[model samples]
Target chain A: MGKVLMKGNEVLAEAAVHADCRYYFGYPITPQSELVAYMARRLPEVGGLFLQAESEIAAINMVYGAASTGVRVMTSSSSPGFSLKQEGISYLVGSELPAVIVNIVRGGPGLGNIQPAQSDYFQVTKGGGHGDYHIPVLAPSTLQEIVDLTMDAFDIADKYRSPVIIMGDGMLGQMMEPVEFKEKVESKQFDKSWATTGTRGDGGPKIITSLELDADSLEKRNTLLQKKFAEMKEQEVRYETYCTEDADYIIVAYGTVARIAMNAINKARETGLKIGLIRPISLWPFPEKPFEETRKRVKGYISVEMSAGQMIEDVRLAVNGHAPVDFYGRTGGVVPTQEEIYEKIITVAGGLKYEHENGI
Target chain B: MLQEIIIAGFGGQGVMSMGQLIAYAGMIEEKNVSWLPSYGPEQRGGTANCAVVVSDQQVGSPLVSNPSAVIVLNNPSFDKFEPKVRPGGLLISNSSLVARKSEREDIKVIDIRATDLANELGNSRITNMILLGAFIEYSKFLSENSIIESLKKVLSEDKYHLIDINKRALRKGAELVAVF
Candidate 1:
């Protein structure tokens, strides 16, 4: 395959199209506006359906209903619009449907301006809607990773019969890069016997609902869902480590912030600081293995992000006081400069240079 | 080698397309590249800008603060990004719209009357290609042939007729910067 210079949002829509997402329902918003627009233009060429629903709520509900038929279906939006789709997402999970939702996060508390932000970290990782449910969350940094992970999101959703979320920021959505897409192929490799297509009369119509009137049945259902989530945690954990062989200082970051931390890690290494990084591709599973492996001989861990301190909580939990866990971030649509992150590492080191322990 | 560049101008000055040309050329040369634009309200209000990072290594932090090169097409863009260029970096400005000739002694500055020259070439839209051409000559980041190959990717098929003029504009800008 040859590389093409493409925008993140448009390429992401095509990424799903290649993964056989034939049904797309979404509302237009900044950053992710391009994705919905791309889907509207490209889906029909592939003999698919693209709907610009009246509202994000309506779009998500459309996804929920289409997903009942066991089709490759998905929707996308920015920060505030994503919040509107939370109830539908929770409903999709409760019903155990395979659906993909994308949130290209932006600044917010209200209708904040359009710029990159990671403020939705806790909302996405902790399950935005009400319930004891968790959606498989994939966080990809670059456009190439976005293509790879968007395809993975659909597969993970179908394989587990659970909802999936692609957590991206405005930066990831708006940026452009050279990306080579995976080749398109025939999909729908999962069994849809439990779908609501119709009754085959083998026994009777299958009932698909989160509502269970019987207390014992509800308990059993919840236990089954928990076990499924546990399996996802065990099998779907994805992470990458950079120069962490014998690191004294480790930075924990994900998505766009992870790339920024790499710049800092590279610079810090030049000054004789043993710095490394852990980039968690799957945000929900929270890649705890890297923290345990590096914190053994590390002096400190800093979580860099575009939020006040959401992922830092997960970092703290993963470190478990094995090493000092610190945070450095900027909220409200501002991206942290690489120099600021390098300074954070220096501050975390208490301005003291590391001694050459095993002089490499 | 890494080239962190900022292309800033008014909304319709081809600032984004200029950045895209460089990025696409970088991709043609098989280099790691990222192009991030300052999106939303600013495009409608006053100025528009985009950051381009072309690197031999992996590109990180697409938001470039200290740029290795800056090309400003208007006075406002000049005022804002003139001092942001790295020491010993390069600054290329459109002298027709930007009145400030040079302000920094640390960096090499090339002020070309891009708008005037583009007008002479009968299409003011090619003004950005001129500045882009000058940057290409100065940094040697990507070849003109690679840029021409990528032009076929960015321009719609209907506008294929303008590729030759855009190529001429790039050459004009490169010629102006060759002496400086």
Candidate 2:
């Protein structure tokens, strides 16, 4: 099929439908409203269900209910709205329900502004709700990636029977770009034999609840969940490397910020500087392998983000004092300009060289 | 080569559509394109703007801080964005609403009376199309034919009746640039 010009939010909605996700629940939030609006209009035509719940809290619970029925379900919101959905998300996690949740993030501490931001990094990757578990998080930088990830999110959620979060910022949700939707992949066959789809034929009644009241049983369940998370960590780490070989410095960023960092990298390269970029595709898995491998060769790492240094802590943990890790970011709904990033790269690179010469 | 442009105007002046059309035309030409609008509270009834980037290679940032060209449809937009154009960049302004000329000596500025021409053409809404026509002619980033074809796709079928006037307005804007 030919490529079509589409907004990122609208394309994400279309991709979800193409992925055979027949149920969607969401509330209205800036930047992410287009996704809900698109679903409201398109889902009904495809024999699917689209519901706008009274609030984000209700929307996520609806997703939980639908997912428990062994059907593909999804919900999306921005920062504040997403915070409201946290309780339901934790329940979905504890219940082992498969669902796709999208957070087209905006700046916030409390209704900060309606602009793109990466402030939700810690909130999302660290398990927002009260739980001893982790959800696989996918951050997409481009519109095409958004479509591909939205489709894959459903499968990923079903594969582990866990909710997968697709994280994007306001820019990704609002921008328009050319995208070609691929032919749908053959749906993966998941074992829904244990689903709570009513005790009709063969299997007897099955209960779908996260309430383990007993301490011993809860601990056992927690151990098993930990095992699943470990398995995911081993199998699901994904990242993209650009111009990292023989580089003096590496810039780590994700989502919209990564794209801007690419511009900085290219600019620095034009000035005969060796700068590279490591874009984390999966935030939960948090591709640490790149940093571990590149730490010895590079002088330092620059963690660029739209927040005030949340992901930098992850980079520091990965680096483990092998090299100095610097942070450059903008908060409160402001995006760092390309020139600003490039200047930082030059200053950091020069500072690293000076420190090496002085043996500091 | 990468061409970054900022199209700015009042809320109802179709500033966003102008950027979308340019980006779509670039895509039709098989180039990488991105269009990002200023989608804040100010978009309701205030000055609106969008940034468009077209390149043969992958476009890194969709936000254009320093643009290669700018299209301003109002006095406020012209005053705000005229200084942000690169030294050797191009500026296309709607002279009908904006009475003052850009004072920048480094950049090339082309003033087209798009609103007046659109009024003469019996439709004031196509002022953006006229300014877009001038922008394309001045910048030559995308072929005129490609832009016209893109318009056919961007406009809904019910709105196809106005295609003729839009085309005329585009051509008129281009002619104004040529004469200058």
Candidate with best lDDT:
2
Report, for every candidate in turn, its global Cα lDDT versus the true structure: 0.90, 0.91
Candidate 2, which segments miss by more than 4 Å at Cα?
A: A352-360
Candidate 2 lDDT over residue span A205-260, tens digit each = 88888999999999999999999999999988889999999789999999989999
RMSD of each: 3.1, 1.8
Q: Score candidate 1 by TM-score against the native.
A: 0.97
Q: Give lDDT tens digits, candidate 2, residues B1-180.
A: 799999999999999988988988999999999999988978466999999999999989999999999999999998899889999999999999998898888999898888988999999999999988888887787888888888888889998998898899889888889876
Q: How many angstroms is residue B86 displaced in model 1 relative to the true structure, after the best TM-score fit?
A: 0.4
Give the docking tier of candidate 2: high
Query: Could you tell me the lDDT of residue A74 within candidate 2?
Result: 89
What lDDT tens digits, residue by residue, belong to model 1 across residues B55-123? 999998898999999999999999999989999999999999999877679999999999999999999
DockQ for each candidate?
A: 0.85, 0.90
iRMSD for each candidate structure, in the order shown: 0.8, 0.5
lDDT tens digits, residue span A112-151, model 1: 9798999998899998998889888999999999898999
